[model samples]
Target: MEKNNRTIVNAWCMYDWANSVHALVIISSIFPVYFSATALGASGTPDTNFFGLQIKSSVLFSYTVSVSFLITASLVPLCTAIADFTGKKKRFMQFFCYTGAISCMLLYFFTKDTLIPSVFLFGLSLIGWSGSIVFYDSYLPEIATEDKFDAYSARGFSLGYLGSVLLLLFNLSMILAPQFYGITEKSVPARISFLTVGLWWILFAQIPFHYLPAGKKKEKRDGNWLFNGFLELKKVYGRLKEQPYLAKFLSAFFIYTMGLRTVMYVATIFGATELKLPSQSLIITVLLIQLVGIAGSYIFAWLSGQIGNIYALMIGVAIWIGICAGAYHTTEAREFDIIACTVGMVMGGIQSLSRSTYAKLIPENVTDTASYFSFYDVTEKLAIVLGTFIYGAVEQMTGSMRNSILALLVIFIIGLLLLYRIPSRKVYHLKLDHREN
Candidate 1:
């Protein structure tokens, strides 16, 4: 295999910039809340009361996402394996990205008091969005030099944050100028803004498809693609047993990633439910996080360069702890400012470092990068299960998301402790001898 150079690395990083618009708009900022309050099947005026719980639109959106994550968890690894066997990571990425964009565009068709279509579209979009990311993530080693893994990974995340910001600015413009843009109503502007993401995602996603190289196609190793995919998973499991430190790092990452995912997924929801903030406020808050995230990525990248990956990751974990604690204790809108501050500071660092760290652990010559990343995907999917299940259980039993927020402390603390036990320097020296195709 040829060594990856700087140009390839930058191209790979740009893929993040392309797809992140979908994440920022459909997943994080505008659509979820819209889906809850207006998109789906609800009676006249769109009932806010469901199952004796009266919560904000975003919290309902979070609940729906938790449900979708539960389903996606069960299926992504198998899908990943198939993509690997077919040697079509880039193609598969394109397929899913198109589906997600189409799903996002479908949001515009959702009418008042008819949310079923929107809900379905949201779920489909989530699946397509997340599934494509597994393949996108697997391509990191193909584009990054071993020594520059951290820098490249951080670059991807930084570009992604910037991309999200640009889209958000456009969205904010559409929203503010709805009347000028032919939107004559209150929520129509936001709905139209949601449609823009699908367009942006599809347009920008072409860059990688047009420019970045895909790994070579591979013949099926032992059986049919799906069957062989299943077999590949078992082999991965066996490999994990021999790599206990990597396994341990994975275990720690799984938990903390879950906590991070849950906090981000539910932050806007929690604020709307607990703080009773309006939609406009939520938009402003998310914009603030996006801006802060840009600064945060560079800060952590520089910090990691000075102190090492472990130190940078620990800083992120510490901020997470602070975020959970702040959420648990705050009673006013100002508290959201605290939560946003911590999240903006740490989210990119944690994700970028985790991906690069795992890239280091994996051998350079692994043929089925998509299949191999299936293990990584499983951990990520399972993290959602653990975090959401625990959060939902606590919230239902205690009747407060505050208690749920506090519960994440366990995930962070324990994951951090386990992370401390891994010897990064030793793992970094491991040979990359697995080259079978």
Candidate 2:
């Protein structure tokens, strides 16, 4: 790979800006509240039956996210592996990105009459959004040198935060002041917000699609693409065992990500259910997080430069432990707001540093970058399944989300310990095939 080019790097980062609208509006903030209000009615609790089982709205949403992760975890590796074999990662990324954006647009049609369709589209969009991320991340190594990964990764996340916040602010205006848009009902504005996310995603994605370089080399087509892809992935898995440093990093990543992802996905619901916050407060809190996150990503990136990525990540994890504790004790809206601000500061830092740290750990001269990132993404999605499951199960068993939040402390601690086991200097070596080089 050549040295980093400014245009390509900017283009790559813009995808983060593009897709993050979906993350904020559809995944983390708006959709959850809107869907709960719509489906469960004014009680804000789940009274609806799914497959003959009565479930709470929060539990139902968590399980829906788990199912989406399950499907993505099962399928993304194979898809990424096939893309690597064919050297068409860009095409694969485009497919997932467009699919996800269109799915967001489809959410406009969802209502009480079409609950099943809503759930299906929500899951589909999640899959599309997350699946595209695998290939998007793979481009990092290709676009920038290892030494620059931290800054580039942080820039991408910061841009994402800023872009999403801008859109969410507009969406909030529409929801909070519907008369300004000539809308009479809240539901109409909420549905229109979903449509805006899809349009924004599709429009901004074109910049990256146009500017990102194509795969440098192409593998010859064998009659058996699926079989070849699996064989290739099996070989990569075998090779991964020889890289102890990378392997340990991945272990820590998987564990910590469980806590990280669960918090990102469920914190809004927790605020609504446990803190008894209204929609306005929850949306505002989410906006604050995004605003704070822009600084968090940059600050953490700088912190990584000062103390190293590993130590910076450890600090971020420590803050998460504190946040979990605070969440357990929070009863007032003010207490929750303080915790939300803390979460915002650490969330972007941990996520940005983790990506750069992993990028630095990857073996030099590796060819199947997409497949490598597929393994990374699959680890993350599976962790999400485990984390969301534990969260939902704890709530069901204990009859309180407080316990569920506290349970994350164990995961964070375990991840910290695992991270400690990794050597400060990169020690693992991987030999590349000449064909791959």
Candidate 3:
């Protein structure tokens, strides 16, 4: 278990490459627009009946995303606790990887007539994509030394941006020029793009599954695993309370990430709906973001090395506040692209730094890394739930996404205040054992 082992670090990082295709193509870019267009019909804001209440298609889409994150947040801790107890984190990761990949492929069958099934599969795929990351991120403390955490984490995100951008470029070509591929309908190419994401994810995931080491198996215990898992989670919660710095960091992370995740998830839709940008412009703008994000991840990592993680994170938060304000005022396509580029610069930095910062703060003696990261992941997922719900509610009531974007400013300000209170001394001088295996 040598620190900064090349094989282990590369294998671990490759998982980001595999999964980020889904993050870009399905979650962030193409599929949301496709879903809205398909589900809402020609009117662009059709009413739908859910259980007993009627709601707008756009609002329903946001609520569906919230529900998916809510389910993942509730379930992942127990699942990770079981993985930690059994020493089977790799197996759990593999299960989600396969589940999510298959779900992405199933999206090829989605149609306007199959709204319920389409939404179900979309949520399932999101669960698979996001749920696997808890264990994948937990591997960071095991694979790299403390000093290398920020760079290693940033490298993973950089690779993800590069890899996903390549696939998206190909998919964009197919969607934009269907005649070259002998496809008659526009939706046909889009469906094929979904299949490409599925295959790419599963095929690349083999690298991590083959090379990332599985730690020693735990001793078999005499108890119901479900009950044992809950007990284990309860113990971790108590331990988290004892680490006040980590607790405060997680609170700030939860608040800011609420705004961050919502913006990332919905930005493309916002452009299409509120700004009335063409599909071609939206796709091109996303490509620009991905290209810029590769540099953004590296820049923020270097900045963290020079100025410290807290300051770099605060800089990112400040940029996000500006992006939200800009989105509210920008109506022209050129202005929107500028805002998108600004988003590109800060998105990867904030996300990558947050992960590395948390990795640095965790207790080294702790054996159950998956359980610890499960709590971290839960904070993020719960934030997504709250952020998306609030955004959707505001849009639904006011009938304008402008107000929804502005509301995120409040969340960002609160997060910035919380982040300022975190003592810098606690994070910078950690002396951790590098012999984790």
- Which number leads on lDDT? 3
True-vs-predicted CA distance for residue 94, candidate 3, Å: 0.8
For model 3, residues 299-321, the per-residue Cα lDDT tens digits are 99999887788888988998898
For residues 1-437, write the lDDT of model 1, one tens digit per residue: 45566666666778789788877777676765555457333453323554456543444565667777766666666777777766667887888788888888888877664455676788788777877888889887776666777777778888998998888887888776786677777777777776887888888887778767755766647666667667777888788887786688788899898799888777766766667677667877888887788778778767767766766787789878877877788887777776787788788888888887788777665767676687888788778777876776787677777888888887888778877877655334333323331
lDDT of each prediction vs. the true structure? Answer: 0.75, 0.87, 0.88
lDDT-better candidate, 1 vs 3: 3
How well does model 2 score by local distance difference test? 0.87
Local error of candidate 2 at residue 397 (angstroms): 2.1
Q: Where is model 1 more than 4 Å wrong at Cα? A: 39-60, 426-437
lDDT of 2 by residue, 141-223 (tens): 88899889999999999999999999999999998899998998658988998999999999999999999876655657666
Q: Show where candidate 2 strays beyond 4 Å.
A: 41-45, 221-223, 426-437
Better candidate by TM-score, 1 or 2: 2
